[model samples]
Target: MHDTGHNDVSPELDRRLMAAGLRLGRRNLGQTHPNPAVGALVVRHDSDGPIVVGRGWTAPGGRPHAETMALEQAGDAARGATIYTTLEPCAHDGKTPPCTDALIAAGPERVVMAIDDPDPRVSGKGRAALEAAGIVVTDGVLAKEAARDHAGHFSLVQKGRPHVTLKLAVSADGMIGRREGERMMITSKPALTAVQAMRSTSDAVVIGIGTVLIDDPRLTVRLPGLAGLSPLRVVLDPSGRLPLDSRLVTTADKVPVMAVVGPAAPANAKAALIESGVQVVETSDGPNGLNLHEALAALGEAGMTRVLVEGGARVAASLLSEDLLDEIVLFRAPVVVGPDGVRALEGYALSAIERSPRYRQIDAAIVGDDLMRRYWRD
Candidate 1:
């Protein structure tokens, strides 16, 4: 919400710029982990309309930021042009020079930004530097949309934890599976494809030991071109009970997998898991099992900004019980599973309806006869 100066700018133009930035930023979601994905666009005004001179998104691995790339494309023509970016330009020197310096040198007449960077080093300094250089700046344009686009980065900087999402597919009667140890395709093909797309955006996908034992899922993105963009696979096995021949362990050589264990886990079992190329980390234990908060803190320290929890009941219940869940994605099929089927949530029982956690529905859509509902914490 920082402002350098105000001008007679068109609101429609601001919306168009923000939308463009958002579209570009989403191109490299999984590739940029610790760093935020940003986009920049350069515009020049004419009698007819504003012409886009250059556009660029953050590069892979987070170096050579969007502002620098867009400015370089504009070159001498950048002078007197207006720059629109999804995030406030960086004001500090890190792996590269400060982006604020690049924008200043480019001599943009005005800069319109969606949201200010939450990093302390560049929060307000970027805007301050631009104003000092006699540039007009307008921030907080389409700010809410920008925040949703960069939720992972904002969560990491402000809350010191990864943005957590719980994903599950249930029947019409709210049953996760018809029987225990049964590998069933609960959702349709289109819903499965959508789930794969979600996996490609997350930094890591987590499951409990029960899921590992029952499903034996590879937990990789299998879409046409997104197979290589699979996220890191994480398993919460407090007692080190995960089998060495599990799919996650077998695929460790091709995809990264980590096992979170408790201090009291068997030494031989831990060593065997490590021998299978699975990285192991120990955390504190709670009455239910591994301390979920401590494990998430470890992941945050390791630079994980977002986590998708594809659960087997126990894991979802534990995260909800600890008040650690941030979002929920429910894929509801039209089929019905009777009383004998396994429920979607277990272990956490609410004593009263008033004590239940509240969430607001953000989106709902139909995917090949299945209903996909998205909700966020209220």
Candidate 2:
């Protein structure tokens, strides 16, 4: 919240650099597991007056941190350069050396970070080390913006689980699909396209076995040029009822797929799914199916910091009832599927929502004929 460095650089310039760094950091977000996707920029002022010498984001798999890459690019230019970073440089040695050590070794004149590291191991130590080395550390340049930019990491550290989003599309009458496991499209092409883009951006997408049995969806990003960015596909199957010939099982070799089954799952079925390249996660069971707490823990262990649950109503209701959802994305369409349609809340539709965790609308937009609303847990 305070600027501690020298007064040579304008606040506007610092913000611009940090903003650019944040954008760069997000480019590889879903791929940077076990580490936050950080962005860094090295700026040097010459006759041109404050030109960026190097810029980099945290690489995939979290190796070669942002600062490491940027400093390497800056080389000798980093001696008197200023650094702008979205999050505090890590100060602890992890799979790689601490980023703060790299910054100190690089001999930057000043270091500006959007926010201090939330992890206790690094928290204030990064700034302390920089100030101790007389590096003119400018802390909290854009604290609020950076907190939002790094929310996935914050959630992972503070909550001990991934940031979970419950996404659903419902008819005007509040129906999700036709009854009897018949899949129905409630939204138009634009909404579907948006869903694909969202899937591409998240670390993984989850769905209940009910969804798989009913829809047989591929759950992959079909959009051209973006197919490669499709996130991991996770299906919650309590009794190991997932069909071996299902699209998810068949495509497990091409993309990552996890079948989260309950304790009572058949050993033969688990072995068969594993043989087909699907990761069989055996977790405890809940009313809807697999115990979501254990299921999410397994996901976080596997490096998913942000996950999307694209569900069949039962799963959505279960997440809401259990207070497991961190965010909600609802698409309200104009069409009605009538009384015979499936309710969005399974055995408990829109009624008794007062019993569920309250949510505050954070954003809303019109996607084709659907009204898309985003909410945060209140």
Candidate 3:
């Protein structure tokens, strides 16, 4: 939607820079799920004009990362180019090499960074590395925008835990489902795409048995070409009640965990699921259903620091009950259904909600007629 046709570095250039920035940001999006949406830009001058040499961003499938891609594209021309990027470059080694090393090796004249990496792994090292190389570096260019794009990932990096998001699709009167147990699509295409985008931005997607039973949804990313790039699928079915034929069980190839309460799932349950090839893990249960704290801890131990909670009221209440939630993201549709139906949070008592997690407002916008607000948990 942004025009990058004009030259002369006018507002148009800024738009193009931003659009390019968005593209670069997108590069690291899927990889940083559980992290933040980060991108990079390289500006080099040639004999003809200010030749923008390379546009490097993070890639899908969570490999190589942004800085690596940027350096690969910049090769040789990086000597005097300015590297414009969203988020602070990483210093610690991860799935790829350190971003700071890549920048240093590229020999850029300057580095214009949008926001600092909140992950303890590279809180300040990337900048330190660049400055140490005697490169002119400007930190925090378009910092707010960078933070807005990667609020969920930033929350995890800063807090040392996943950004807990709570999404509920309700009726005009605020009921989640109908009295007769019928559930319909409450959000439009944009909203659904927004949900899919959230999947693309998170390390894992979580839901309870109720939702699994009702929808049997794939719970995977399905945004055009972005379908295969999705977070790990997680189900909270303490009773091991999820149907074996569910699409989530059949489709997800990643190590899917089913947080259950019993010592072991029933023989029939195991037989049904194993026949379809889905792994199940049983852990201690909470009074509600699943032990959310244990499940979250297990996820973190398994290197999943960020999680999204797509709820069926009871699950939302369970997470809220443990006080383990880091953030809350509620998508309230314009429609409303009256009382006598499922409330947004089903089991928790209003008076019992004592310690509400604190969050900082990041951005609020209308994405194709749907209101989308992002927040960072403190």
Candidate 4:
């Protein structure tokens, strides 16, 4: 904890408290559906210096919000203390009472928010309520970092689209796989594990029907002790041609699977997939195949905030061309796959990606023998 007095927080202390709150907010980032993960901290001052009274993150299922937990833990120590929250306290009631009311009742002397909530019902109302109750309010302390943590929720609420992450593993020469459309390991084990971690953080992992038919990809998180965190597997089988004996179907009972199909899909295929515990969603066909916009909208309606597009080039090109992708996670291997190999982003111009203004590189690192590059839309 950083030292500070009542109503006299320094910039350094503000960053430290806000950073701690943001870290706590990520405890359940991919697990909280229909609600953004939030973190809160309660701090008090004494002759010795400032001390942390309590801290809490949003609960797993969105009930019993962070403020409630922290306030309960703080007890009488909360009076005249400062509360640091990653996002503005929610003012609207859903499964629980308004958090602003709880904060007001706690008799906190000050409330600091990393960023205001974007939900219309709580955007500015939470701060307004705090001020109305005579509690000092601070806004936008490390707002950018808070927004990054809340990206999925914001995308769903503001754009009616789940945050899409496009993952591609290519060789040094930009080839994605070997000839004949076989499943190839472009990156080594560590990079594969990193990709699995990415899968664990998403609500769903998407792939085109071609990938299913050719690669028969399982698309599940293979990491030990974290298999339960594997995201829902989504395959775009517009023609309803997915193989029933595939690994995805065999494990549908263990992990959720959704097949997005076109309206013209054969009833028999759809029924068989449903019989195997697969959730079949029907939408119209786009210029490519499945209407991705409608498919993503349906997912957002299902309360999925984030989805990973682990593709077979075609789906990736479609999502990129249609401007649906929100982020990119690329793995580049050191070896070349030669001219006989499958190229990345088929049917899309490389220059479009090279010169695109909407996306900016956010991070790059070496994962074992492969290099990972991540980008975010501006």
lDDT of each: 0.85, 0.86, 0.66, 0.86
lDDT tens digits, residue span 1-378, model 3: 221122233344444565577666764454554445567777774556456777766665445666567767878888877777777788888776778888888888777777777777787777788888887766655666666566656655554456577765555565676656556667667877888887776777888888888788777787889765677777877767778667887664554544444444576775566566666666775566556666776666555656788877888887776666665655557765666667767765322332334555555777555566554555
lDDT of 2 by residue, 145-253 (tens): 6776677788888878888888888899998988855466899999999999888778899999988987898999999998888899999999988899999999999
lDDT of 2: 0.86
Worst 10 residues of 4 by lDDT: 1-10
Q: For candidate 3, which ten residues in a row score worst on lDDT?
A: 1-10
lDDT of candidate model 1 versus the reference = 0.85
Collision pairs in model 2: none
The alpha-carbon deviation from the true structure for residue 286 of candidate 1, after best TM-score superposition, in angstroms, is 1.6
Candidate 1, residue 226: how far the Cα is off, in Å: 1.3
TM accuracy, model 3:
0.79
What TM-score would each prediction reach against the true structure? 0.95, 0.92, 0.79, 0.95
